[model samples]
Target: MNQLELLKKFTIIVADTSEINSICKYKPQDATTNPSLILKAVELKENRKFLNKAVEYAKKNGGSKKNQLTNASDKILVDLGIEILKYIPGYISSEVDARLSFNTEECILKAKKIIQMYEEQGISRKRVLIKLAATWECIKAAEELKKDNIFCNLTLLFSFAQARACAESNVFLISPFVGRIYDWYVSKNLISTFSYNEDPGVTSVCKIYNFYKKHNYKTIIMGASFRNIQQILLLSGCDRLTISPVLLKELELNNTVFNRKLIPPTIFLEPPRPLTEDEFRWEHNQDEMAVQKLSEGIRNFGKDQLLLEQIISKLI
Candidate 1:
């Protein structure tokens, strides 16, 4: 079996793309999208129809310019998610606006709105996972949403503090970004040596996975932002791995036999106590890499979201 086929035996392969064509090509079980990916997709000539439809819907609703743009943006986000859903048999993670990352109330309201949009089109909430940044407020928002049966995927997770808090909040899943963490270490020249197994990104996910499994937490650990196939291979037994098409293609072509690198340890380790809001903040603050990346990720996603609105404005 090719590496992709073998990997599937131990992990659910999720296509991490905004392009419908890429998801269809890879045939992953699930798919994920963010503002950045959606922005890229909206710029594509083939995806212009979707953008036009969103603009039209927003115009018909007849609201203020800001409301129209906001409505149009949400419409397009759900519309693209609905389109992508047709190609995948599993859930599609539609992210909330990154600008709301720090606002729990806004995050919950937006998540409900997205879910309602999908429901209006005959799609059930089970097929949708609201993607939120792993801010404490967002996690609290997710906690409330979970009570209402809305599932969440916490993204932009960079440290164990974030992971622990996410698990404690009973999030549906947490995406501990592998490649982003690796990128930070590399950029800082902090690592004197590197290997797939020793890659900071790989190590981060492993630690999260072990912690989750040790406590038997139901919250899934889906490793995201892979820098290469090796990182993907290193995390073969993670709850799930959302892979970009580039790495997916490489795995499909390489006929290498690889074993699962991560498995729940038979012995449970001592579980850490749940963190308070202040503790969570201080712990996150202490991890310079996590603090920098989390801030950067939100800023970058928020910027793309604005850029996407610019494209929609032209259509309007």
Candidate 2:
């Protein structure tokens, strides 16, 4: 069997894209989208119809300029998600606005609004996973959303602290970014001499996976942001993996033999004591790479979100 088929034996493969064609071609069990992916999709002529529809909806509803912009942006995102859902059989992760990453109340409100929009279109909440940054406030917001049966996928997670917090909060899923972590180390010249197995990004996910398995935490770990096929292969047995079309195509073409590198521990180990809010902040701060990458990810997503809004504003 090819790598994609072999890997599916142990992990659920998720296409991480906003392009309907790619999602349809790969036929992944689930798909994930963010502001960046949604923006990229809107630029394509084929996808512009959805954007135009959203802009028209926002204009007809008529509100203040700011409200109109926000409404259009949200509608566009949900519309893309709705389109992608038509191709996949499982969940599609829809992210909250990165600008609201730190505001617990705002995150909660926006998450509810996205779900409401999906529900309005006749989609059930079970098929949608709300994506949020791993900020404490966002985690808290996710906790509250969980009570109402809204699942969440905690993104921008780098440090173990973030993973632990999400697991403790009973989040539905956590996307520990493998490629972004690898990028940070390579940028700092910290991994000048490392093997694929020793890749820092792979190592980070391995640590989190081991912790989760050892302690029997139920938060699903879906490795994301892979820079190469090796990183994806290294995490073959993760609960789930979100792969870009580029790498997914690579896997589909190559029939190379690869074994499962991760397996659940036969015996459970004691989980570390939960970190307090202050401790969580300090621990996260000490990991300079995590600190930098988390901030950068949020900023980049926010920038793309603003750019998307500008595109919609012109249409209005």
Candidate 3:
């Protein structure tokens, strides 16, 4: 079996793209999309139909231009998500706006709206994992949404504090961005790269994995934002791995065999870390790389969201 085939034995392969066609090509178990991916999908010729439909949707559901654009943006993400769901048998992670990352109330309201859109399309809310940035407020938002049976995937995760908060909140899944973590370290030190065993991103995920396994936290760990096939290989037994198409194609082509690198450690009873709101902030604040990357990630996604609105503006 090729590496991709073998890797599936360990990790649930999730296609990390807004391109529905690629999801079919990869045959991933799940698919994830953010503003950046959705923006790219909006420009694709094949996905133009969804964009046009969203414009018509905005027209019919008339509101202020800002609200219209916001609604249309949400519409297209779900439209793409709805289409991608047809190919993958598992969940589709549709993100809450990064701009709303710090607003607990808004995050809860937005998540409900996204779930409602999927339900209206005859898709079950159970099939959607509402994605939110791993800000303290967003985590609290997820805690509330969970009571309503709306599961979430907390992304932009960087530090142990973020992971602990998600676990205590009982989030459905947490996507610790692997490659972005590695990138921050490399930029700081001006290094080319680290080997898979020593890679900072890989180590970060492993630390969380061991901690969760030791504590028996049931939240799923889906490693995301891989920079290379080796990073994918290193995280072989993650609950899931959200891989970009470029890296997915690379894994498909490489016939090299690999072994599962992440296995849940045996339970060793210890005090569970249910980080308080202040503790979460302080602990996360201390990690310079996490702080910077988390902020940078939210800004980039927020920018892409605006750019997506611009596309909607021109089309409408």
Cα lDDT of model 3 by residue, 1-316, tens digit = 8899999999899999877667888899999998888888888898789989999999889989998898898899888888888888999999988999999999999999999999999999999999999999999999899999999999999998999999988888999999999899888884566567888899999999988888888899999999999988998998999999999999999999878888877657775647788888999999999999999999999999989898899877
Worst 10 residues of 2 by lDDT: 269-278
- After superposing all C-alphas onto the true structure, candidate 1 shows an RMSD in angstroms of 1.1
229-269 per-residue lDDT for model 1 (tens digits):
99999999999999998899899999979899998878776
Query: Any runs in candidate 2 off by more than 4 Å, and if so which?
Result: none
For TM-score, candidate 2 versus 3, the one ahead is 2
How many clashes does each candidate structure show, in the order listed? 0, 0, 0
Q: How does each model score on TM-score?
A: 0.98, 0.98, 0.97
lDDT of each: 0.93, 0.92, 0.91
- Runs in model 1 deviating more than 4 A are 269-271
- Assess candidate 2 and give its lDDT: 0.92
Q: Give the residue spans of candidate 3 off by over 4 A.
A: 190-193
Q: Per-residue lDDT for 181 in model 2?
A: 94
lDDT, candidate 1, equals 0.93
- A best-first ranking of the candidates according to their TM-score comes to 2, 1, 3
Clash count (model 1, backbone only): 0
